[model samples]
Target: MNDRENLCLLHSKDLLDQKRLFLLFKRLAGQHSVSIAKNIHETIKEFNSATFTEDQKLFEDLYKIAATIENKVIDVDVLKQGVNKLLDNRKTIPQPKPEDLCVNDSVFQNKILSKENNQKTAPVPAVYDMLSLLYLTTNEKQRQQHFHDLTKYYYRQLKDHLKQLSIELDEILPLPVYEKKIKDFIPNAKLEVILHYLNQDAKEDTFTSELIQELYLYVLYPKINIEDCFKIAKEVVGIDYNFLSYELVEANGLLGALGQYYKLKLTINKAGDDVVLNLFAKFMIDFPKDAFPGGEDAFPKVGDAFPKDEPPTLSLQEEFVYTIFVPELKNIGLGNICDFLPRCYFMRSSDVMVFEDLTYSDYEAVNSEEPYSYEMLLLVVKKLAKMHACSLLYEEITSKGSGETTKINVQFSKYVMGFSQAVDTKFKDTIHYCNVNTTVNYVYNQFPDVAKEITMEEFRERSRDIFDSMLDKMKTSGKYRNVICHGDIWGGNILFKFEGTRPVDCSLVDYQMIRYCPPAQDLMAFLYINTDKNTRTNYLSKLINDYYTEMSTIFKRYSFDLSTVYPYEVFMDSCEYMKSYAVCQAAAYYPSSLDRKKVQDLLGSIEKTVRFFAVDKTEVLKVLMKHDWIRSRFREIVEDLYDLCLQK
Candidate 1:
């Protein structure tokens, strides 16, 4: 027979097996329920048909049957006895015809046989294989043995296909009602609930209690009360409790976002007992046009706005790392540094990602004020070097026989305009709230020695020009070797595991802003935002050396010569190029990183500084002088900039 005919015959055989199994289960359950009812009625005379109405007796029997199923009180001895009695009475029992066994007539037709052979092909023997044995064996003992084997085979098949029965039940009743009904039969009711939801053929318009129960079982806990299921559904899934109808559920502001996230959680399972999974569902759906100010126009598009080869969205970038980059890193025996990555359970496009919660391991994010210590800084530098080396290796592997120049798949240039625009907007708003000229004059007066080369006009002109061109300069500068940068490397993006006063390990998170740029972009941004002035000045050189050592070690492992690929001198020059970008970023972001009340206080002082310093007055200088932290930070930035300029 041809392959197609063979496949058709095999499928037909499976269908026949399923149909026979279904019939066997129906007969077994019916006989078992009747036998249990007879015994119950015999014990309780009041429940007997003679004492009670037929309908009432039937109802009581059904209730007892359900209770027995729920309590798992089925007796195997009684079941065997009942099956034996049924077999003995088979002469009086109606036999299912061949037509009844084959649900679809066309499926059993000659079309499934090889026409070239024109010979009847014997079907593959299966669970029903012993039927002919029973008839052929004239000896009572052999016939009985065949019957027992057939019964055992059919029962085993019935148990194996229970999930298929559940699917059939789902079609007969609504999923919620089907789930409730199956709970009595299944020990793991939560598994049934999860399976039912996942197997759903119809899309739901509103969140149902059944759906909430499934989510609670998977995302939160295995055993949860129904009331708490509703509560968690409301609190965690962002559903409304007051309105449980489809209208209200569909109208929920967070429904679309929650739906996508819920789908993601459903797709992933727990990795191990030690790891706690936490999904950061921070995405928004259908945001208002005014929310992003410029709407879709402000964001870059695929192919048109960014290179066609690069990943167009943050989700795609993260997906690439999890699927391609991380695995490649592990392949090269650098999985130790990869511990910083939360174990990715699964990722769907960019809309949904499930990760193991690192908090379970006592890892916490450091805030802006709490900078990384010298030891922690060394670990971070090593981690960054590993990350960069993996990217380099990935580029080499993907480019190997393509005969094309190796390039990182991420596009950093797309974000430059958007970031510059945001900085400019923030600057304008600050000037509108206070006075730019006044703020500059105040800084110049407060640090006359630092501002000796620049007048108020010069300071105003240079600051605006610097903000506008900073990203471009960082991108174009050949001082550093281009590498994949963890685009958002501030304190908030990193998590550390501390062993009492010292950070022994660290992990990076929030890969949404990953990009292709010089390694210094990440290095400088991380240092400036996560370290104090003294830490930056004193340990900067050592940290760079630490990063290079790690990078060189990784290269050597992969048989690449570091001298030609990325030398120490090239790295140092990259740091110089990154210095200007880092100082500007730190100054711009410093105010936002402060406590809310502190930010308000600083803004108030800024307003007063602007009013006084507008006409070259020194009153604002006193306010600036009071905030020693701010003054020190600015002083360090100016010193770094001055040194950079002198080098030029």
Candidate 2:
């Protein structure tokens, strides 16, 4: 406790600290070079065994080790921080009790525990106390609001940093500066690839085709190699063959609802006779940069909807639908499931999916611009009901085996339509800001009587509320006896197998948006998107009754009582609840869906249509209204939405 004893103790502690500092530097130097690390280790060992008289020489040796580390270390910032902390401590002697002189493991742990206890017992700041109380007292909504605000604040900061970086790079900053900054911001960021994507001057068609070709090569070639094909021919077909060439089949301007299609023809010599196998290739399309005149700036609200860095989730979702969902249906005794599902041949995770071409079997997709006739609609609705029944039966069978009954199968709990966060935000933003606004504005323009009850803003607000309410209901578990609802049930997604002029059978394509939701969601969505106002008015009740009857029949076949699971009354009520959802979706998609022109065609060739439902929506609306196809279809959608809002 005396000054001389304390001084001696401090001196001893300083030597221990010096040894610890050298050990730290030696560990860091290992990352730079093994030889340098060895030298520092030896110096520390020698210093540790040195007498008090040799302290000056050891101190000089330690300085040299520090210099070596400073020069060679890759992480200079961390090394500098350690060194600076040691330097700062040198000015004041650390007081340690006589028991602390040993610096053993027990003593170190005790010190830490003692420090923590002291900190805990210390007087607390009032602000921190208030914060703790607030956190404990706040409800879910309040906590969500706070978290949302914090997220938005952080996002703004991040966006500001990105904007500044963009500006600095535009001014031709030195490469080294950006290299350091970018790595600090985004670990393992590929500057070259990002820059290439931003600066490429390739024409739109060439760029898209090249991307598709690259994806096709990456996905299909790996699965369809020569050896694999030879094995397939010998084992499955009983004919050994030479794998020949493959070529892309031209569709002549056919565009998919959510993707681009390419029919691939593969030729192989079977018994010296040329045999051709057709493969249907579907590639998940991103929002091409050239499709927007001002690039992301054109869609300010959803600029990052399809960022180059993040791949689209459509292919992966559809892959799940094929590999997990439909296969499970067959496993659970739904023998006719494959009749409705295209035989998927090869599917990559995010971009490319290959299937046995359904067209080869006389299955043809309905025109995207045309509504399905009542007979065709009836067939499609019954098929949808069967799919729902199979999903229910599968859940029932699996739950019974597991001894736990869940409302929805655990595998199908997550919503698949907007499985990715980016896509979900984009969809919600498009629906709320673009779809809701456009539909309301159209109503205001075309139907003054429909718009008479409220202002345009009021109508937008009410429509948004209605759509949000539908989303809430959809998200609610055990809502209306959920089924595996085909999230995008429409004409474009259905393929009819015809016998001469009449349709004999049908198969649903594009299972990208399957969700565990009420069957009414699929039913209403089908009617709203693929049927005109007149068609729905004339045959809506009939179609619903047919869907119910088919579903009841399938359930009865599987020994399920429809009344015990999903009653007819409950299905009708769910349909009424989802009516607004269907209307909102129809309004959003009709502008693009009703037109024969592809998204790129309208945005690229038509200057005024560049901001279609993305930006300057009113101007684009004016241009769209000029077209009879969009105007007529969009009017029906808006009229339905307006009526739904009035009822609300």
Candidate 3:
């Protein structure tokens, strides 16, 4: 057919198909300018008017708009290819057989041949997909028809019409390609709807769907090379594999506070033998403003306190522990070098770290809700003790060889908490400033009898004072031997390997917050944060002594004595001195952990959390005190702090 006849045939389509055709022209026009696309659409939209005198006049109008688009378009061939495809679909319009009279008739027939009768009777591609296949490709931009300009009624009407054609979309298009197609047509399509048309199941909720969608993007679109995989396989399993393929499983429930976790399952071949490797991948989210929950709204409020300056190095520090510090300690081969650290499988830049999946050996984190029993606490204590002992051994050996006192070279060793120079703004912005102050205020107002003459302002000031004291106590000051401290020691960071009901092996997982301090920094934090006051009352000395005995044995293996290096007397004093710091840490952490439902209630609106901390804690404290768990936890913590700091 000629250009005039083809233009008349395209104009004969129903409004939806006409709009689809307009999208093709618009896509062509978009290659030049969005305004040109708008001009072309408006010009063609006038074609349906009854007042239109002749096809030649209307065709000339469209041709004029096309001429303007051609001037600005850099690739004239691509534009012609798009326009030619649209005309070809119209020129070959088939007359439906009488038996297929029920099928909706349009210029472009949406049909496929039936396998049973070898007849063109099957309804396969929906009109939307058929039109999509006619003009668009995977490389096309993700442009959608703007629904913002449409009325709500018209929008729903158009959506219902398109939904009918979405049924056969899956059979004709791959998910990723189809996703780009449907989203172009339905600009406001929910993730669930897109997944439905693509024949992929979405997570139940919008939040989860968005979260899983992001994870799929990261996993499916890995910026990796074959050489990286080969190197990882060689180093991890001692296999030089020439081939590799892998699947990533996002650990949804185990998502990190400031990052993401995945189980990287690999299949590789060497010498015609296939070997499977399962490794854990940790992705550090450097900027929480974009990747994390609460987005920009909640980030500014929490950013000051929550690793604002530390995220870039958070993974780096953990990577250093896995790749350098731990490996060097292991090379020394101390008698008590228990297998407590995950084996590093791969390290990608500074954001991603891969390690041996501990679950393969039946190791798993204990339930954070359950309090640690004596046995559980004992295993963790022993592990920490051995790790601390190794750090001491390294320092001692290095110092002796160099004939000088050598310290760990890790930069994270500098204390960042409390009233330190490194984190003056951090302390005032986060837990210490908001949560701690809130807890103390709630305690004083609710229990004036127990609060005594210590005024509310004094109590708040005392909290800061305790942290200021903690900064001083964190230093060795030639009084105690410094050992590497797991800066964050809590239930979540310890993974336990159990045999039936018996507690057996355990590994200390997150080393992102490692510090060079006395062992009391970790021990007290673990004891106070993970165990209850009653548990500590009954077994505190035993736990401490158990840690000391473990370290003492390890030291004796190297012909050194713990008594000289870290005396039991000095250890006891350090624990006493660090109690205020531990209590403060517990109070800061309890608001989120003790009753997450209330925390969620508080954080339901990021604005609420931001508002809660933006001003004085008076009103928010009242809101927080309503939750029974929050009330009890903060009350107990205040009592502990009061006795530690304000008791006469």
Candidate 4:
């Protein structure tokens, strides 16, 4: 077309572009990157509606090219550069896109920086191409990696910006920065930087898409329903994220001995209530209908598959899993408190993987640089204090039975469901190939008599008694205060967030065993799982002191008297209880955490089990035995069965 006609077209398109820009801002506020890009393309077509001046047409052509950014918005900073090219002398405004930046990115680092900061970088077309493609992809984990590569997947992303907003970013952030940056369009990008940090703080293998989705929605749309995300999995998601699988021993099959797996991507309005997305495990497909051939019997019939006589893998693997997302609920708005869980707790839940499920050790060995230490064990004590506080305030926060529902139907016994009782119940050959010479086996082997007396059946019976006792304590404790206890606060569940603000700031997990009970339950349970020599001597007392100190911190918010509960004597009582449970919990779990070879031998070491418990039991009983009248108390606890059963 002629210059005059083109000029007319350019002017008309500019007007249309102005209107569209406002809408783009609106979509950005909603964090709608895809929709925003589509609208921008529509606005660029306005250039074709009218004629333009020679100079105007040239500018309009640039606008048409910029409109092609159909995945993410033109880093307004980039657009500002084109604006300068159009109006040659206007250099004062911050240029969203600079001509010198790499507009084209083959690896996508530039596009990520653009999306991350909502601005331009070295203008290179290769960068744009890679990002544009990633935008179109359907994977979340892959998308996150693409974004992460730009920042080297560390807190280094805008680290300088983080320090600048030191006070705000230093604390745990409520959401990811990329989502926040696109919203509100604020001048200070502090929130955006903080968002990146929150993402970095999460361990990669531990990163579940459900947590990411849940956090994003909860922080942004307070009213979104969780049902919308029930079906979301690795194949679905809008945000570009990548699964981080740590090196692990893989069992063959479509399911590679599922330990911690993941999926990731972005979203449009993919959120449910509280804007948080569930991540632990996805919904398991329908049984039989989706199972391998052989009608309903094709799949390994659920039972105690762990060769107790041989303990191939802990019988835990056979547990039927209904869902697969490792839950990491985020954006927990506890008003002023930054703790994510106060707002939401992580439940490694699956409809199919309920308590009545198959047996299997779902976890593998964690490479702890050092074994559990006094300092680390102390951190766990503090964790118990915090969880107990939350439980105590359960009634104040919500009416629902937070911990009771889960605990009521916990492992009542180790009965092999669906199988007949005629099977030779006890595993005969106790020594496993892996645990023969390990310290775990050696420690237990020292005392063969007591360990030999306790069989799997006996253990199950004892567990039932323990459960019954717990129910009674829960009832009595309810009159005082009950908090959500990590019913199984073993070393495996209490994670150490060593880098975050609260050095010992622990994030709990595996909530299947969550129970509504006294905080003492959590304190005892965690100590039972992690307590050892140096822990008992050098750190135990001081740790209890620290827990009280931390308790005071949480209590100050609710005006609680520290002395009324958790006194030195109460703590001592609690410690004795925790010690008693050590033999039971350790026997079942040591195999999963210790170096595999050593861990296995220890599990089948009945000789060691008897000996270890003998010493442990004596020490534990010594504390309670101080009161010569304790035998009667024990009899009452064991015999008053109905009173001990969980009421809820």
Q: Write the per-residue lDDT of candidate 3 for residues 1-648, one digit (tens) a residue.
A: 332233221211122343544444333222212222223223221111111122343333332333443213223344334334434443453542221112121122222112212333222112232232222211111111222111122223323432454422122232323323332222112211222222212123232232223222323434332224445666765534444355677764452344567877777666788878888878765543432233444332322443322332445456657766776776776534846677777665445677888999899877545568999999999989988888888888777877988677433343222222234334234534565556566555676655566775776677667756665655444566677777777766788889999989889987766666778888988888887777888998899889999889888889888898777898899887778878878776664455444454554443454444433445645676776655665667777877766742
Write the residue-wise lDDT of candidate 2 on 1-648 in tens digits.
332222121111122232332332222222212222223223211111111122334333333333443213223344334333433443332332221111111111122222333422211111122122222222222322242232223223323443443422112222222222222212111111111222232123222222222222323332232222233333334444555545565454554545667776666677879888877777656654454545644333323443332234546457667877777777767766446677776554555667777889999876656677888888898888877887778778888878988555365433343431232354445435655566666545765555667776677778778766656545434657777777777666788988977878888888876777788888888888887888899999899999999888887877888877787888889888778778777776666566535543555433334346444456545666776766677777767877777887
**Local error of candidate 1 at residue 620 (angstroms):** 19
lDDT of 4 by residue, 1-648 (tens): 332222121111132232332332222222222222223223221111011122444344334433443343344445435344423322232433221112222122233334544554432222223223222221333333233332122223223333443422223221232222222221112112223323333222112222233233333322222222322322244443333211112121111111322221223343442222323331222222222223333233325643232222122212211121111111122223323122121122122121211012122222332346666666666666655654333333332334433221122122112111112322211111112222123323332333233543443345455533433443224233444444555555555555333344455544434434456656654554454433445665676677768877876776555566445566566555444343334333343432333332442333333332222233223343344333332322222221222221
* Top of the candidates by TM-score: 2
Give each model's whole-structure lDDT: 0.45, 0.52, 0.53, 0.33
lDDT of 3 at 251: 68
Name the regions of candidate 4 deviating beyond 4 angstroms: 1-260, 263-369, 396-481, 499-504, 565-572, 596-648
Order of candidates by TM-score, top first? Answer: 2, 3, 1, 4
- Candidate that beats the other on TM-score, 1 or 3, i.e. the better one: 3
Sliding window of 10 residues with minimal summed lDDT for model 2: 44-53
Candidate 4: lDDT of 544? 61
lDDT string, candidate 1, 1-648, tens digits:
332332232221132233443354344333322322233213221210111112334333322332344323444344334333333443242332221111111111122222323433332111111121112111222222233334444434433343344322122222222222222212122222222222231123111223332222322321212222222233333332221211011111111111222211212112222221233333322223232324445343434554432334435455566777677668755576566567665343424455554666788766544456899888888888888887666566555646776665342345422222232344223322233333344553555576456554555566555554555744423445566567667665578899998788888876655666778788887778666778987998888888888888878887777777777788788886677777666654443342223433443433333332122323434554466775776566555544444443
- The global Cα lDDT (0 to 1) of model 4 is 0.33
In lDDT terms, how accurate is model 1? Answer: 0.45
Give model 3's clash tally.
0
